[model samples]
Target: MNKKTKFITIGIIAIFSFTSLFIFSFIFFPNLQTSINSSNDNGRTLQEEVSNITIIIDYSGVKDNEIYSNITLINFNTTVYHAILNCSEIKVQDYG
Candidate 1:
């Protein structure tokens, strides 16, 4: 092909190769816990059992005003409401 067409074809191939590599890395490596786990499979790590949570609150009397941020961990028994309370200082009337 011409000079310009050849350069364009090379650029497209490079981009495609980069995109494919990025996608495959995630597909194979997956998550941090997987890498940390032992290959022998004696037992699962604590990281695998617990979850990472991030709570965002926006109550500035305006739209999309995220004032408070809380990052905490929760087990199987932890409720969603309790998770939020752990992250922020807010008033909630509980009728139980």
Candidate 2:
């Protein structure tokens, strides 16, 4: 082939390759986004969902010290699953 044809062929091939990559990314973008955004997931964040709570009473009456009664512990297992399911279902339903 002539130099011009070879250059044109190479250019076309390059363009097609670029376009193919772009289209492929487009097709796989949601999954990729899911994986990437999943790694840095905002969904699995430490939200304030209290699961188990315990209150402590000090008979010594230490008013100067903070009481453990005010402390609250949250377990994410139940809430995370429910929240994830909710968001996934909402996304599937195309809801904002």
Model 1 off-target regions past 4 Å? 32-96
Residues 2-95, candidate 1: write the lDDT tens digits.
9999999999999999999888777877663554456647553443223465566766777675544434555643555666766666697889
lDDT digits (tens) for residues 3-75 of candidate 2: 9999999999999999999888887674564643455556455555654433333447555432332233445
What residue pairs are clashing in model 2?
Answer: none
Weakest 10 consecutive residues of candidate 2 by summed lDDT: 64-73
Question: What's the CA error at residue 34 for candidate 1, in Å?
Answer: 3.5
| Candidate-wise lDDT, in order | 0.65, 0.55
